[model samples]
Target chain A: MHGQPRPYWNPLVAGLILGLALLATFLVTGHGLGASGLSARLTAALGSWILPEATAANAYLGGYVKAGAPLAGWITWEVLGVVLGGLIGSLTSRRFRPKVEGGPRLTPARRLTYAFVGGALVGFGARLARGCTSGLGLSGSATLAVAGFVFLIAFFAAGFLTMRLARGAWT
Target chain B: MSFPFYDSGFWPALALGVLFGLALEGAGFASARKLTAQFTLRDFSVFKVMFTAVIVAATGLWLAEELGLMAPRSVFIPTLYAWAIAVGGALIGAGFAIGGYCPGTSAVGLASGRWDALVFIVGMIAGAAVFAWGFDAISPLYWAAPGPKGQTLDQLLGLPVPAILVAMIAVAAGGFWLGSRLERRFGGPIGSSDVTCGSEGAQPPETGTRPGSMRPS
Candidate 1:
């Protein structure tokens, strides 16, 4: 592991740790994990910065302003920790490198374009659904929530179909 | 009653998020190639890891509730909004396949200096802005779908928690077994391939190649 990056953890083991973390969060905070909510708040904050009156007038963006600073929420701090933790993990494993991730079939430009489109869709969808993979899928499912199971089924169905349609970009 | 430590704010949440990120990165979920491989049927690492985590957390939480260590009602439950959730799921699923990273994983990827992850993050914020901007127009359709608020699987099926837990465990176990077989057939061992893009003309070694063989000759 000196020159080369260390191999990733076994999936099962890493998953166990993740599960423990989830349990711990539930026990302590009386809530589960989330990602997209922070993104929404960030968006609201940005909107408020650009157009204070219009953003504050909007029902969704206005909520953040009413709640005070959008960035001063628990999820926002947790996301910041996520970035810090990821940096630590990557650095310790010697996997930190500036580059894009894509298959040989696609160029960096094309891959970035796809990434942006995908991210936008995720952002839009997460808001509509009220959560994301972490918030709705994992946390909600663990609690046996109906919405979680539904999201899981629908997510996989769309994912498989989309993957087939976009084969050239990946394969 | 004394265990939750709720009076202590932010620190616990932050610590848990860190651990969550670490587990994801260490499991190689931060890599778009590895994640997309799940959709391509080339690898099932994502499925295996996620199912395992779900089972572990579900079982543990149930046990804690049984022993009166915690109250189930205290946990935040997402309300059911049928059509919105389903459509949202479809959008997210398609995004995952195209972008190759989910919200949590993309953060890890960005932290590790993946340039594409940055672009994806920007896109996500923009998308959120778009949604906020169009909230009034979409809200009618979003709320039109009929569903019970905060319904659970056990409640929907009128099943006992123990029975549901058992069924979930079985399903997860079966999924893992099937995922392992799929990976064995369509893909190589986990983490055997490096997916970081290099200079133009550099091809990532084919799957199943020896780990060190990705280097240019």
Candidate 2:
């Protein structure tokens, strides 16, 4: 218990490290890190394999099917890498634990429900905006993209505003 | 212009993305409690990591672009589409507050052995599917209120990349300074759980300890 895990790195230091990583990606791959798009592609592919007709007929998903193996897409692979990388990081950092994180009094089921609903909303919202936090907020701002700033402000503002509604999650 | 693998291949890109993801998770971002502390004005972790990354990348890209090693255009930035951005940002924020994870973080959490992360990922995929099916009806909104696309700060304000990059670094520096002060005033490390225990890991600081709760640490 003495070493349940470690403290997080310095915020400024961590941010600088991430910033340089993004820069490296731009220099090397000419793109930034992304996760949502890849997941979308995978979803489309799985949908296609399970329900080919439906996937092909769906307006948004059909494009991905027509484009070929969705899993082969760049973002898809990158997202996979994200999962793998995360697992490795947790393992190395000694933070790998199987548990449901929620408010002190919240049940696992309630936490799961909120997680699903929140995730769906995030997905839909990310699609509408053309990206999510990492893609729009971080990568976007790194390039000084105006949309990046807008999304960042909006994201934080809404989070704070809606935070009260979910007070049970905190003390 | 002389970088060997501007288009090296899929493996490298994937590897780099994985490294980035690992870095984010390793920094304690995989936990929603950690990320949301930013808005609660409790912890400065998110701001610290995000701003630092921006500064580092901005400076690196600026220097590379200046030296002609990189053509910034290769990186993609979406068009403004104000309504979409606003609506989407709100939804994402709601998700963050409710689920304590983002698209990137949900994936990280899933990897880190959280069942909720899996649920979130599945929901995200389903949500994406729903959006895709409704794309035709939403097409207009997707491109509404179009702002600049892939427009960098240097290009927009007619400032040199170096100058703009330097300005960004300065802003981050200022933010860091303020964040530290807020943490001190806030009573704990900005985002640590209030019910502190000397458990397995080093827990984050508790919230509402600050004089003014909305200090934006």
Candidate 3:
């Protein structure tokens, strides 16, 4: 397996591990997993950094500021852990490499642009919905939250419906 | 009050997050191509992993509650902000199709050294800032009602938690079966065969492959 990344784990096996991890999260924190919330907080912190008065004056950013140090939140630390974990997994699997991922038809620049635009959309939408795939779909659904199911359905539906427009980028 | 773990501080959260990230990367979710394949209907790994995880967690949570290990009320559940969630979900879906990475997976991708993932993260932060700046204007849409507070499937359907969990497991099983069939029909080798891990400055890989030929077991 030298110079070759190991094949991905069986989906069921990986999912089982993930499920147990989520169970652990619930049992310990009385809360589910999340990703976007930390991003939102980081963004608010950035806002406050550049423009303190306005950031504190804005309703949304201000709320985060009032909550104390944005990076001090548990979710922020969790996200940091995620990055570390990913690094460990990639290193062990020998998949760590700096590269742009895109279809042959997509130039590296175009792919990067699309990634940024897509990320922005995700950021905005997650805040609007108050969560993302992890928060609303995985965590919420696991706990039988109605919003989780609704989000799961709506998310896939929208993805399927609009995928054609972006087909070239991936396909 | 049934569980005293929340008071244990941030270490537990961090450790769980690490596990979550490891699971995601181990499942090949660090690859943008693999993730986007779900939208293309060419691969079902995304659906498979997600549904399985959901079912497993849901079952475990339900079992814990039944055994009196934890109170259902102690778990944080999102309140239903119906229209906002629907609209937001749609936007997220579109982003997923376009970007091929979500907040969680993007972090993994970035860790695995994907340059695009870093750009995506920056974009995400900018988008969040835009939302913050426009919160007052968008509050109505974001906070739209017809929203019930903390509604769960069991409560909504007037069914027992176990019954709901059973239904969810059934759905997951059905989904997995269908996903396998789809993979057989549409799956192919990911991108170009020349593309390998840890190859920086490599050219973009060619798209698609002969259906049913390169499906990973």
Candidate 4:
């Protein structure tokens, strides 16, 4: 959708901006950016609406619904912001377009299939560990959360292994 | 005092989250190829942006805490557990490679009109369900080695937070340098052809195509 593959801003500069944003978050909100937790919450809310009694009884689903208004929660808003932010960024960069993102040698369907499988694993892992890369690895590290460290190790190890297996997808 | 306005309830947090997400999009971080470039050692944007933000925020937090403006204890910190993190991280990493987007990025991807991102989102939700259902069976493994919520690298290594943060900044710089060099070495020929998505004016390089490297004529 854009030329020059849409020039990227300098990483250092971008990082600095992100830092300020985070700092602002801390100052006004006393926290950091997060994504996965809310996704779980949304899932729980939907599950409950579909089967209130069962969802309420389910351990994980129960936690999110019992909390009430999963979509109304702070993290969920942040996620909404992420969506808006991404759209704006892509549009401004002239890089916005609807397409399947994947490697060569793969059809859109295949790429999407892999995306689904991979995303599922990530979701499971994030929930299993109580957080994903953002909550555990990034935010956790920011606050010196020990579980965050372990998550970093496990996540990277898995990525490396999967990368090897998915070599053809990339090449 | 009593910051984290949303923590007090919900609306404020949701607003803040959207703002943050907007910021991420503005930063052009929603793209998967851009993120994976870090792994290929071609682009260090991820490290650069992530560490810069971490260091800057850490410094500000430290200053706030030192000034007694904010109680460090009040700040939320993820409790540490070796086992849960290890297994979770590995799986997440694998998912990153296969899916080309993390939980956060997938949202961005979806916003940018990527149909595949939707699929990934569905997959993630399913995965979370599976994990939640199996939690009862895996309870023991999840709780292994619990520690103080704020236990960190500095504490474990006997270094001060500020010092460690500085070291991290330096490390990030080094990574960026390496990434640039790799890009120069591997970036295929530029302008070979930009793939367009649908009728979009001009498609940026698709996932498989490496930037900064020469594209085969």
Native interface contacts kept by each candidate, as a fraction: 0.75, 0.70, 0.79, 0.71
Better of 2 and 3 by TM-score: 3
Better of 1 and 2 by DockQ: 1
DockQ of 1: 0.71
Q: lDDT tens digits, residues A59-141, model 2? A: 78888899888777667667778888888887776777666666555667887888888888898888888889889888888
Better of 1 and 3 by TM-score: 3
- lDDT by residue (B1-217, candidate 3, tens digit) is 3762674367877798899899988888777878888887777778888888888888988878778888766788888898889999999999988887889999999998889888889988988888888888999998787557789998999999888878877887898888877766765324322234335442544434454544223
Measured by DockQ, the strongest candidate is: 3
Q: Rank the candidates by lDDT, best first.
A: 3, 1, 2, 4
Question: Which model is ahead, 2 or 4, in terms of TM-score?
Answer: 2
Candidate 3: where is the Cα deviation over 4 Å? B189-198, B201-204, B207-217
Which has the greatest TM-score? 3
**TM-scores of chain B, in order:** 0.88, 0.79, 0.88, 0.82
User: Compared with the true structure, what per-residue lDDT tens digits does model 4 show for residues B1-217?
Assistant: 5444435345555555565565555545565555554555545556566667677777777777778777765567777767777777788888888877788878877887777778989999888878877778878888887876577777788988778878877877786677666667766211112333443211344544554454222
What interface RMSD, in Å and to 1 decimal, does model 1 have?
Answer: 1.7
Of 1 and 4, the candidate ranking higher by TM-score: 1
Clashing pairs in 1: none
Chain B TM-score, structure 2:
0.79
lDDT, model 4 = 0.69
Q: What tens digits encode model 2's per-residue C-alpha lDDT throughout B6-78?
A: 5636787778778777778867777766666666656677777887887787677667766887564656665
